[model samples]
Target: MNDKNTTQFNHENVKVGEETSPTLLRFFRRKWLGIWQSNPPGMGLFVFGLCIAVIMAIPIVYVIWRSLFAGIDRWQRLLDERIPQLLWNTLSLAGAVTVSTMIIGVSLAWIVIRTDIPGKKAWRWLLAMPLTVPPYVGAVTYIIVFGRSGWARDLWQSTPWLVNALGDYSINIYSFGGVFLVLTMFTYPYVYLIASASLRKMNRNYEEAAYSQGMSTSEVFWKVNLPLLRPAIGAGGILVSLYVLGDFGTIAMLRYVTFTAAIYFQRASFDTASAAVLSLVLILLTVAILWIESKTRRKNKYYQTSNTYRKPLTLKLGKWKPFVLFYVSVVFFVSVILPIGVLVYWSRIGIRMGALDGRFFGFAINSLKVSGFAALLCMLFSMPIIYLKGRYPSLITKVIEKLSYAGYALPGVIVALGFVFIFNNHLPRLYGTFYIVALAFVVRFLPQAMQAGEASLSLISPRIDEAARSLGYPPWKVMLKVILPNMLPGVLAGGALVFVSAIKELPATLMLRPPNFDTLAVRVYFEASESIYHLAAPAALLIVLVSVVPLRYMLKKY
Candidate 1:
């Protein structure tokens, strides 16, 4: 009886252990997961962010899979024939642009930011204002003014005195070299803006210390300041590279055979399978560039100072200031002022002809719709990752951050192509809609939103929320009452940036626009292509004007 009772108790204890084991597991899960979950506010923010990220990522995966797997045999054939050529052409342009933008942008940034250039204040804003002019629009200006049948070329041809003195081949504005020149002009601002911002905010005490140790001024700047600004330069360079890689307007207009151009051709040729495949390959190349940027940036990490200081040390350029001023003037003239003059001249021509009156209202209204929606949607999507990384900050968070950023480096063509593949087959209801294009824009540009929100929220202290808890406020209420007021400005700034970029966007807008719909960007492109140059002017000018606001804001930040 005793033995039997002991056996029965042992068996009962084993069953009890099994049942209690789950209870313990549940308790542990709730405890650990609560770190992420109990902040119902943050979790809600994260879920909101994740939906945006997943939406953004969907096109990329779809494009890759459809292009690669839909017709494996066809992609294989192209892989052997056209892919290599397309890849090389695309990468070569990206590489060349990257190197050129770095050199020009760094020089321009250093001169304007660190030295005592004449008109630094106005020039600073003016220099960055060129970004307001879309590369395609710039290309259009360069073409109509200087092409073989161009007004300038025609005048030069007619002027016998100057024509005899100067050869006809003085300006070949429609060539590979021309594309590079135009791209470098607009793209350098990306680097310049960021580098200049870094330079201004940087404490000059480090350089002063180097000078005090017997280093020359130049040596101190080169050795101390430049090295310190490596991360800044790297960050700026990455932005330039991404722009060059993804830009289709300038390349397409210049007749350059970039991957973006090639993919567009593939899509138009009723060879979407090929387009999808090429887009996948192109995205992979962008991924490689991003990886390189990440590795290079790791070598130099400079964070904002814990304490602020005034009293910037000014090393007199003395003899070089005039030279610097002249150089900057030429760059500013060619890239910024000259382009605006061209557009203004064209706009006046259009107004005098009474051409811009009829569709102006409709076009402007349509532009606002697209730009506003894109900005709102992109911000909505970016909020999750921004909050997650801002609050939780773990390896998982980092992975999610990196994943979300991957779509950013991708060319808009790849993103568009991905959408084209997915929408054409699976979601037939979305096959031809403005929302589809907006979704692509969100995916292609989520990082901009994330960066903005992340910068804004990361500045807020977690203690604010903890303090709210101490006062017995609910997590959601604390967030709504305390954190949101602080975060709103940043989120709006980011969304505004997205709004500006979407307004000026070219290729995706061109490819994905609903039939009969016309945004300013598209209006300018088609009208310009058809050589209704004057008709495209008001739209072009408006694009520049609209884009100017964010460009100014970004210039200040950089």
Candidate 2:
């Protein structure tokens, strides 16, 4: 009887334990929903972010799928002939440009931000103006000045001494060296902006501490400042590397073949399968670069420890002022003055030749219509993704945020190709529409919009969200009523960035636009490619003018 009673007691104990233990669903609910009692992202937000992620991921998925099923013959052809050479050319050029830009960009930023450079306020704007000129436009300008049959060569040939002494020593702007020079000139601004911001916000106390430890100014910079600046440099370098990797127009114009150019040629020849294989390789290369950047960034986390802050100490150039001034002048001259000056000079000639005719108006309208639509779509889509990421800070939201950036990292050519397959195969009805062009723009430039949205959303306190929730506002309503109105400035800034990027986008537009539908970028590209400089000049100038719209925002941001 006693043994039976003990058995019953143990059975009751086991039952009580099972009742108290947490189930998987219950545990997840407590952790996820318990984040904010007043304002948590609902199930709807998660579903929305997932849907966006899937859409953003389509291009990448399509490329991979096509590449894998490209058949053994196509794969072998690329592997045996094209892939080896393209890989070398792409990596070497990307590495060279990245190193060159980092050196120029970091130095120039330090001089402008940290030194007592004369006319810094003007110099800052001047330095950043190069970003207004697309690398292809810059390449075209350089070619006009330095090509074998260029104005520079014509002038030199006229001088007997120059011709005799420097026989066959003319500048060849179509070679690898020329491509490197032009790209570095335009792309260095990426690094400069990032490094400049880091320098501006950096706590000066570390530098002072280093000085007190018997470090010279140079020593302090090398030991204290540079270590802290690594994250900024890495971020900027990744952007430059990606730009170099994905660049088609600059390299193609200069006649140096990379993966982007190779893929374009393959597709032009109707070798779609081969293009997919090449695109997969390029995507892998880009992924490796992104991985390296993330690893480097994770290894270092720089932040100010105290709230007490002071302005950065200005370094006196002293005897080196003239040299610094000369350096700044030369960079500005090469990057900004030369390109715009060439455009203006040629634009006058084009105007005299009546190149800006009725067709020009059509090109302008096409550009505006497409880019405007893209900007609007980007703003619309960016809100939900960024809002979820910024306000909720959950694993799902973080994954969605990362996936959104995948489109931006990809080359425009790859994105365009993916859309060709997707639209032609899946959505055949929407294949040749202008909306396809707009969608391409959205995919290639959406991250810019998301970045701006997140920045704006981050400044609003969660308390505001709680207040809205207390008043019985749903997540969507709160976003519409409270969050968006407060973040309009950032939203506008993002929209402007998207507009500028879309206006300049070339490869995707070239691939995706309907028959006979030419944007300004396409006009400029075709005219320039056919050596019709006079015709290309007007459109190029207009692009530059439109690009200036975002100059103030960029300046403030950096």
Candidate 3:
């Protein structure tokens, strides 16, 4: 070994390689930087970081320029009038949805992860399956099931007290309360995914230690489990907040306008300038959330970091099993079974009448093709970004890693507006094409692929790639021959998620599609809008079915 290689790493009461003086370390650090400077991958990473900065900054610049040059007067007036109401509505909805999703998701995750819930496998699959069904599809079912012409309304029309609550209660399914209920019901999967992941990975010693102190199960959970689970829970909450901030379909279907819908409205009303101004405000709100997440997410290990790992102790509920089952059943009935049932019933009726609705089918085909292409495209784009971040981590690459957030928090309408502005002006020929729709999908979902890729890459040691290189493999050859196989599972999971999401995307597709183009999500929206839900139901069911298969696989890995 070289004399300098004797530099030491010391542990408690244990001496490792020899310690180095400060001057020697500074020299090595400089040498490392020189090495980084010479490496092609490192330099390529720098260019990638710069490209991400430029791409993300495009909308920010567009929004600011439009607000300054176009919306100066209009924005000033709206800032004084409608802005506060919008803020209250949007933030209040976010708060409520976040809290509610937490309760539902956390509760179920705890039950499955820590308790002897007998049907664990089925429940896991069922809980995750809801993610594939777009919230607007659920909104459609809720409206039909509880609205004026609904079964419950008709059944309760006789009893006076029941009639009062049920009749005047048409549930409108298109109000603030309706938005909250539908969004919360669909989105609990966010919390469920992360929390359950952490819960599954946790070493059992912590819970056992708490119980050894004579604490009851609930006490152990509250005092020990939840606090430890905070980081994972917080990550999920960050995802939920970003998602809710960007959501447009269900909320708009429910007739509630957050920044997303407001932006879409402005665009629809031919007010691209004002829409861009609103997009800036939306970005500001998202940055605030991102800042908060950064402050709170201190670096800490959440994996199985100790040798004490074991299965979590399950709580025996005895008679309380009935209550838990009832609660879970009710949740499933409303969120999953009912909506799916409605779709099945409607679809059967349509089949009997031979009402396939060519337009709806056409839209479904378009949705599948676009989302499929986008999923493939996003995986290709994200692989390089993720690999560079993991192996060549640095401040600039870190910033590029964060740049994905700009798209993450952008509402569909805002994404649509950015493309509308850019493509319409800079590349007119590319305007209103499926490619633009795919690009929007990639922007919205690339972070997902990165997260998965990062985790997958972490499990694989760097030596594998080095070994390949030593064997005369070029860098690209090493990635393809060594890295690709290891990362395939994660890349596929993330791509499946992206595919599921792209199929359900509405506002972006709506604003960006060329005339006569349709996707499954668009078909459901338009068909539902015209009170022709029968034609839309089969497509909605198809979306959910396609999504569930992949979701189960994604959840299983965790």
RMSD of each: 3.8, 5.1, 10.0
Identify the runs in model 2 with alpha carbons over 4 angstroms from their true place.
1-40
lDDT of 2: 0.90
lDDT of 2 by residue, 1-558 (tens): 999999999999998878767676688778767664434686776677778777888988898999999999889988999899999999999999999999999999999999999999788788988889999889889988888888888888888898788785468798889999999999999999999999998888888889989999989988889998999999899999999999988988899999999988888898888999999999999999999889878889877866888778999999999999999999999999988999999999999999989999999999999999999999988988888887877666778888888889999999999999999989999998889999888888989998888888889998998899899988877887999999998888899999999999989988889988899999988999888999999999999999897777777777
Error of 2 at 23 (Å): 9.8
lDDT of 1 by residue, 488-520 (tens): 988888898888888888788778878867888
Scored against the true structure, residue 299 in model 2 reaches a CA lDDT of: 81
Best candidate per lDDT, number? 2
Give each model's clash number: 2, 0, 3
Best-to-worst TM-score order:
2, 1, 3
Residue-level lDDT of model 3, residues 1-558, one tens digit each, is 554454432242143223445667888878777755644463454565567556755655666677667745887877988678889988999988888888888899988777777797788777876777788899888878876677766666656887666445455666888888888888888898889998887778887888789999779888888887888788778778877888887877778878888888989998888787788788889889888887777654344457667877777878888898888888888888889999999999978877676765677789889999989987877776777777666665677777765676667777778888988999899997899899888877777777777789899999887788789876656666789899998888888888887887889999999877888888888788777878878878888888775576667666
Worst 10 residues of 1 by lDDT: 35-44
Please report, as a residue range, the 10-residue window in candidate 3 with the lowest summed lDDT.
Answer: 9-18
Candidate that beats the other on TM-score, 2 or 3, i.e. the better one: 2
Candidate 3 clashes between residue pairs 3 or more apart in a chain or in different chains: 8-17, 8-18, 363-518
Q: Please list all clashing residue pairs in model 1, or write none if there are none.
A: 49-384, 197-558
Model with the higher lDDT, candidate 2 or 3: 2
